[model samples]
Target: EGDSFRIDEPIYLYIEPIGYTIKENPKSSYEFGFFADFTIEGEDGKVLGGQKDFAKLDFKSWNFNTEITLTFTYTISFFSIQVFPQYPDLFSHQDNQ
Candidate 1:
């Protein structure tokens, strides 16, 4: 889940674009393409990590019935560290009751 995360842990993200209906333009003359990039967003809507090498979808020779399934994978790691409390000292010297 996005809400839970361990610091300094490496995470991978696989993104896919769906539900895109392409319409043919008989009158217009233009090329179509798409640039897919990977990004990680924090809980406060901040970008923590992103991929520089973006996947490009070239549709120069593609038709209107073309189905595009652009998948991108990104590897990210957090700089923060997880702090764990030491509880061994609490029961180090226990009294017999």
Candidate 2:
């Protein structure tokens, strides 16, 4: 799933999930999912790691295997979004990706 995330400097790392609804639970046009996140020490080769909860998707694209990597000299955040397909249809889709 080639998913990754990284924040340079100081940022809250804003995010939102997109994909499916209650009734139909169909695939959404925008479904963002966070796979991994971590921080690094500029001066030294140190790293700060964190875990992700796949239970909730933050952003999504059509290709689940796309390469999304944010650069910051020390670390980078990789991600991808794409609507593939869901179980049901006629579901209320939220415009968040």
Candidate 3:
């Protein structure tokens, strides 16, 4: 069976926000929540994963919840890499924040 992919093989994953609504909080960062359906599609247009009505975005800052949304444009991107057994930790413990 050659159906299994190799560990070092490269894959592409893309994320696009079809629609979203923003609410202004005004004191600090932007306090925004949205209801959207998303799908994880591979380079060949095959859907690997998806979610409906999912809203789980958290900010870990003192003024996180108090952030007011202002007139701004944002761009979000996603990337992935294959980690082999020979490689060291991609991220250090302290870098997790």
* The candidate that achieves the highest TM-score relative to the unseen native structure: 1
**Candidate 2 — which residues are off by over 4 angstroms?**
1-9, 12-32, 48-56, 59-97
Per-residue lDDT for 1-97 in model 3, tens only?
2222333343333344434444455554454554545554443455545567655653333343433332212122332343323332221111011
Checking candidate 1 for backbone clashes, the offending pairs are none
What TM-score, computed on C-alpha atoms, does each candidate reach?
Answer: 0.39, 0.22, 0.26
Indicate the worst ten consecutive residues by lDDT in candidate 3: 88-97
Compute the lDDT of residue 36 as modeled in candidate 2: 39
**Model 1 C-alpha lDDT versus the unseen true structure:** 0.43
Q: Can you rank all candidates by lDDT, best first? A: 1, 3, 2
True lDDT of residue 51, candidate 2: 37
Candidate 3 regions off by >4 Å?
1-33, 56-97
lDDT of 2 by residue, 1-97 (tens): 1122222212333333234332212564444444433433222233333334423435545554344443222233321121112312111212122
